[model samples]
Target chain A: MAYSATVGSVRHVFPDLKTVLARASPMRSGDVLAGVAAGSEQERVAAQLALADVALRDFLAADFVPYEDDEVTRLIIDTHDAEAFAPVSHMTVGELRDWLLSYDADGTAIAALSPGLTPEMAAAVSKLMRNRDLIQVARRIRVMTAFRSTLGGEGVMSTRLQPNHPTDDPRGVVASIIDGLMYGCGDAVIGINPATDSPVATIALLQMIDEIRETYEIPTQSCVLSHVTTSITCMERGAPMDLVFQSIAGTQAANAGFGITLDLLAQAQEAALSLKRGTVGDDVMYFETGQGAALSAGAHFGMDLQTVETRAYAVARAFKPLLVNTVVGFLGPEYLYDGKQIHRAGLEDHFCGKLLGLPMGCDVCYTNHAEADQDDMDTLLTSLGAAGCTFFITVPGSDDVMLGYQSASYHDALYVREVLGTRPAPEFEAWMQRMGMVGVDGRVRELPVAQHPVGALAELREHAA
Target chain B: MSGAADDAGAGAGASAPASAASTEPTEPGLRVVDPWLELRRFTPARIGLGRAGDALATKDQLALRLAHAQARDAVHAALDVDAIRGALDGHEVLHVRSAAPDRATYLQRPDLGRVLAEGEAARLRSAAVPVEAKGGPAVGATSGFDLAFVLADGLSPVAVQEHAASVLRATVSALPGWSVAPVVVATQARVALGDPIGEAIGARFVVVLVGERPGLSAADSLGLYLTYEPRTGRRDSERNCISNVRPPVGLSYEAAGHKLATLLREGLRLGLTGVGLKDEGPSLGA
Candidate 1:
């Protein structure tokens, strides 16, 4: 089917839904790299105008990627809730945007309508939104999920204390962990991205964090972000496992490039559930997705990068994941270009994920080669916080030496909480208050490590003893 | 230096302020340094940085910004071709450029960096020095040479400028009997740029020593990629990489050369250079 929009003397036509979606997407280098981006700024606005009139129901009628060819397409088609979609079936993408911002689409209303919305519909409506519209709509929806600690609640934000080390040294990892905990971070999870993907190294890192969590009685989970198969092997070896982590993408082929499948993820989830590790709930998966993964893997199949990224949320929501975040700028300038593009993509991912009833977080980060700085990250961090983002990835001093990029520091979390009046996950906050690391007013106590009430590093020495 | 040297003494013992009696009125921007700041010795990660108020201390913040600035500069830094030529004084070095016209285009369009400029391949094919084959009639050889060595500026020209010549010298000396082609010094090049250069030289294997993307911590880290059969459009899985060749902070020049030599010996023996060829030939000690 052809879609057209006229501006002044020019009439632009999009050949298909995928073309319209690609043309309407906010300017990003990845789409341009794929040669699917609109030819000019006027054409982009026209595509957005054309996209707004497409009915939400049309997204269901045809798949952007054929179902027989793509398993991700198959998952979207098979899992769609016709009953839930009946309420908004008649609305166009433009009308849906209006309804989303209206008084009628409250937290409960959006939650009820979530099952009815597919990733494509969510992606479609997001194209018609400005950054503020994305923020305002996402702010209203709360996708609360739990493993040991609950995430995605009103007036609460969580952080993934990513204490990554260059060589996965236990001492270096523990030092950062101690530093992050003192700053009142790690409410979501103390997840580590091991520099090496070997199973033995992964198990050692897992055991180290587990010992710390057990010794200190911190109310949170720990994960070593290795490949899913390595996590599975660690689980089989009786290692202390919490959330199973994997980097997922939108297309089946892209997932294959990551050496994963739906069946493999299910098996990993089943293994984690069998461990019976969580005290609060059984949402035990941690997923990381980004915009350029599919395109980088040569698996985008002609869709825009953002639309493909939204499809990843469909995969995440299927498993009731405890945490799912878009590593927004980690892919670097080739995809998101610079700070402004990274900031916009972060909000779009959060809005789309939250709108689809999945707990969404963002790695408000950038690589050195990208045209960005801490100031840009500050903008995104503040923006995502205002949008009630589920969590942020907090590294030590905002520099991840192992991953070789910059992310929000543990102190950045404190800044956002103070600015937005958001606290850590409830269980983690209570633990910190009990330990005197934070006060009841949700302020992290600024004290030297030795003088602080929680002498976490000293405790690590004693544990070694 | 106490905690920096002694791993076990890294906590508060070495990190506390010099004297308790020296306490004075705090200045407006004064930061309460983490008593265990000495632990910074253990990793390059920015840790134990004292916070002023749930934020990085001014010095620490500026240090991070400085590191970032340096890394960005490393990406845009031009390679000093004469310096590299001076380093490898005895070797026959041929200069070439990739299809990318400038640094900005090279950074954004990676595809442009993988191919040579319009006449570069043709020029190399006609002008390359002829060499005798070492192992008679190798499985993948299109030309007489067994291996082609390429040095590319890649994302971190700092890496190429700092370590490429020394590493290349060490690697060449280690491969005693192998028929090696004249080294190609490529500007604005990616790892895959070695393919057409190698194919033009008719070598069985291509080793591209290029500058890796500059990380905030290590700006001059070099990477070595080896591809067999020497052709365009080779999948990444069909290549083996030995990365982080910057010294002291990363792999030393000698160690990277040793690893490359091992991979070369095994790759030629196995007649492959990718997933099929693992780097288990021998340790540097062996």
Candidate 2:
């Protein structure tokens, strides 16, 4: 027979037919199905072979035409790869006959094709044919290929700076105020600024603080002090200072919006740093800067449409190396246009062009002062990609609430799954550690520790005492 | 029979007695009710009620019924022409009238209405809006908005007439970020026709609000169809639908404004569509 040579060669390599036959019966349907519903391509082929064997046995007893051993072997060779055929090496004589009959091939021709004609050899050929038949089966089992449910209920941290107000507690209100402005209330603590002396400012500041504290029960963090100016002021005193610049001059004192020209931003950043040396310690400072204005509205501070591009380039380039961190709060149309134009002009090349660019660790805050939605998020993410900005900040409760959460979670999960390839729990723990937050495990070491902290801390305290 | 005759005769006798007593020249049984009628009543040529009653006994009465039926048909033809003209603008109309087994079959078989009868496509092509001079960006017409509006016999034609203008106005105002030209309204259009119309107009996006196929409970439903980057190459996945167009059940006009704006923006950004867009997660608001 044509298949005799192939069968003899296969049997010679592994001579354990009886052991394979004994294990065939009493197999659970789920196990058999799962074996066929394998993950890799190789496993899927093996499972198909097993199912074919069962189908052949049933078909042989029925009125269907019997399949020959050579025809069965031919089908197996056509369908499955040679290297992954070992799993189907063991099939009983009955299973082999059944597999052949199920496939409706000539059983007499198969017997004539085999030179040695051992029950083991015949069974193996039958298994191979069964694998081939799997392709033709309509209701074949299915195994899910993608991992969709892995990143459930994960939270992303996003930060933003609110419009500064007076009478805000510096230490206790900064976090909530920024959180409220970023995610829109309840997620973080906020502070009051001491700059404004008006009763209304005081009342509004107090009300916001009470509301946030009552809602989340988290203490507020102070705003950075240098962000306060005549047009824009930090809400709390003794808060870390960051520069507040505006192109709209006296109009800045009146709800200036977030629109600042690049030149003004650079000037403000420099000036604020200088002022910080006199009032506060020279610790590394955080800068939360943003630009705003109506896009169609006329440009202010000698910055017309023509000069805005060049000015923005200069400002971003200058601030690339100075600040500890920066959040570019872009509120309105002016910022949108500026962002698009700046990107088109290759400002990203100057700041983030190189593999080892100077501003490697900067965080971005891309907020729309207006109501934001999913479209806004897509646009912002596109812009961030264009600017080569890797890290993103998201405030909860923006437009596309669920989508925003999903996007953020999916992005983080993909990074872990595809890039790092870490398992879910370990990856989750690592992410929490990086964020300076605690996970479900209650342990709060700054980093993963090898030794127990109780023993080490106890010995240290004993020495100190 | 005698009792019936006696009742009729008694009623007639009471009225005729006064006339008979004062008649100057009257036949023996004929009572003259008026002086002018008395001469005519006595004349042998004058055959009043007796001759009229005899005329009703012939089979010629059926002929009058046929004449009335013909007149009714003529009136209906004229009314149908007027309705077609009003519905189709000045464009010639082609209708495929169906005699279905029942109303259920008519409602269930939307595919039957989608395609025009034989030679209808050709007829429609001849009457279609002419292609104007193509000026502006060098890209193909497919690069921008194709057919902007399509009309249909949704749940309620009245609702379409009422809310279509406002919805279009809101969509246009919100989409200032993109260029929009004149909007067109196609009468008797179907949802599937959106693709063909979009192809004809050379629009990148087509927004169609049509009357929905009404249910027993709701006869005035409206539906929205928005196809992005609309072109011959586009697939069904590229099109997004905002269904339940009427107020209350789904999106309101104001809410639809934001939703449409977001959909258009995403479509523009992604360029490609389908499960890719749906899986892009929820809309801007949700």
User: Where is model 2 chain B poorest over a 10-residue stretch in terms of lDDT?
Assistant: B5-14
Q: lDDT tens string, model 1, A1-465?
A: 889999999999999898999999999988988999999999999999999999888898766888888888899999999998998999999999999999999999999999899998999899999999999999999988888899987899999999987778787788788888888899999999997897899998888898888888888999999999999999999999999999998999999989999999999999999999999999999999999888888899999989999999999888889999999988877788889999999999999999999899999988767788899999999999999999999998888877777899988988998888999999998898888877665588876666776555655733432
lDDT of 1: 0.84
- Can you write out model 2's per-residue Cα lDDT over A48-113, one digit (the tens) per residue? 333333322221222111124222222222333323223223544345445434544332333232
Best prediction by TM-score: 1
Which sections of candidate 2 miss by over 4 Å?
Answer: A1-263, A274-314, A320-351, A354-356, A360-390, A394-407, A410-465, B1-163, B166-286
Docking quality (DockQ) of candidate 1: 0.32
Kindly list the per-residue Cα lDDT of model 1 for residues B1-286, writing each as its tens digit: 0001100001110111111212223467765544464455555666666677767777777777787787889888999888888888998788999998998777667778889999999899876755633434443344568788899998888888999999988887887767777888999898889889988887888899888777775778888999888898787778998887878867898988888988888887678888998877654332
Tens-place lDDT digits, model 2, residues B85-146: 35445333333222222222222233333333355345444444433443443222334433
Interface RMSD of 2: 49.0
